[model samples]
Target: MTELARLKFYATQAHPCSYLPTEQATTLFLDPSQPMDAQVYAELSEVGFRRSGDHLYRPHCQKCSACVPARLPVADFKPNRQQRRILSRNADLQVRAVRPAFSEEYYDLYARYIEQRHADGDMYPPNREQFSTFLVRDLPFSRFYEFRLGGRLLAVAVTDVLPNGLSAVYTFYDPDEEHRSLGRFAILWQIAETARLGLHAVYLGYWIKNCRKMNYKTQYRPIELFVNQHWAILT
Candidate 1:
């Protein structure tokens, strides 16, 4: 058997849904202690395993197939006028990739973002321990891209670089810097970072049709979606 096929995991339980309204779902857990190869992760990603809080999960509903893994071809990716403007607007900001670390600054930014952007969402005020477990724990490869403005922390994006591509796990920004368009800027940074690393693609997790929060991801044109286990290019 191949190395990727040897890594085994199973679905544990049916849990509450993190996205969408009136929908329920469950996550399949894997042994984080094991040394799974990058090829294993790539395969899982193609199969719709999204990295969430140190866990790789896909919507394993018997009746639904809405949550599909979406990826962007970094080589073919183009920065349109608007995306270029967003990048230009944040020209003063600098990025430094560092090993994932738990910090009060990160937690503070996360709380502010959650409260402001997703006030009614379930992940409000996540404590330090929970935040560490969720963001920094149990992953083989993880990093944080710190966005600094005048040497001040304005945003931090946590990501994982898998074999096939980079997966954007999560991002939080200083709510006070609303004018900077931190959320959109962060994604543009990811695309540039992927290109810099010579990576082929950047996985953008899921894009639900009706979720406005997710709809914006579609703006990153020329994204390919996994439909029925095939990568379908979106027009």
Candidate 2:
């Protein structure tokens, strides 16, 4: 048997659940002082850990197990009709992978997305500080994928490159382009990028069954869910 590294973990105080309003949520995070390199992060991700800014954490709620870590096995992935249409619809957009840096245009799109689409969510009233803390951070393997059409920015996907695959940290797009389904296209692009890189999977943070906002994650077939200390294919 392989021995894992000894690491310290801390749990946050109970807070209102972000997905399910009726429940409380707690998070288990690795020690901040410890080194968090790409190798360590990849190991942690295989066991269902997720990164927010510089913190690596996972839900540790005592009363509920609604948040399930999800990942897509790239080799087995197959897009449905709707996802295919979304890809074709956004085919004209150009994608570029660049270093994660603060940009006014990206921030503007993010602010508008939060203001118009997610006013009731926690990230509403988005500001520069909050945006920087959430998406822009000092990570060697992180990248910002920019989507554009005719020189106009449409979406930005913040992704982290792990040893085994890519991790979808967050995505924000022009709310006015809702008809283009930019969010779905962003994920599809990530999937294609993962395959292009010959990676194994794409880690999609957490999927809550009861949350309407997260239901779309299940639409990607051949997805595996981390449950009861194991990853099982969800049919």
Candidate 3:
């Protein structure tokens, strides 16, 4: 008989600070070389822990419920007329699944997006290594979804493939095409990807109803929110 392998990790820090202004937040930074176990990842996710590349993190701040784990039920998802328009507008774009990599094209698109969409934000323009660290670094289970238009790279979405469903970890797009609503389109693509893979849910991270940046998530109907430490259906 063979014994199953185990993963070992310890908490590093939950610094007193918040990721969003109105919400309190804390993160547990894991050692780079720590072993990652499937059961542990799944368990952590249910408890509000999120995986970014190779890091396993959860919100541990005091008395803050703004960052609730938001997910969409793929089976019950229905694109309204407006959402369908957004999809059709980007119909010409092509999605290419490639291994994560850093390139002048990707960086330029990211910079433009940040400058136009998130200027004066906490995330300053990241250098190449920082971008790699943010996107690739210690990824235990991840994939890169690259979007191209007319042979030109338009956007990229880094996702973590979990046992139960897909998680949209981070996304960046060509800010030049803001009118195309690339961010919204990327989300729709994620939901479609989940359905194609026969997955049940698409985890969209935290959603703060009052925050402008988090409000877009609510547009997806028939969603579920983690409330009172339980998954409750919210439309």
Question: How does candidate 3 fare on TM-score?
Answer: 0.87
Residue by residue across 1-235, what tens digits does model 2's lDDT show?
1124687889999999888999999999989997768888888998899999999999999989999999999999999999999999999999998898898998999999999999999998999999999999968999999999988999999999988999999999999998999999999999999999999999999999889999999999899999989999998
Segments of candidate 1 deviating more than 4 angstroms: 1-3, 31-33, 138-140
> What digit string (tens of lDDT, one per residue) describes model 1 on residues 6-42?
6666775665677866777765656666554556667
Q: In candidate 1, residue 204 scores what lDDT?
A: 89
Residue-level lDDT of model 3, residues 46-158, one tens digit each, is 65677765677766556666678888888999999989999999999999877776778888878777778887576665566667777764445677888898789888888
Query: Per-model C-alpha lDDT, please?
Result: 0.80, 0.92, 0.76
Give the best candidate by lDDT: 2
Check candidate 2 and list the clashing pairs.
Answer: none
Q: What does each candidate score in C-alpha RMSD?
A: 1.9, 1.4, 3.3
Q: Candidates 1 and 3: which is better by lDDT?
A: 1
Task: Quote each prediction's TM-score.
Answer: 0.92, 0.97, 0.87
Candidate 2, after superposition: displacement of residue 233 in Å?
Answer: 0.9
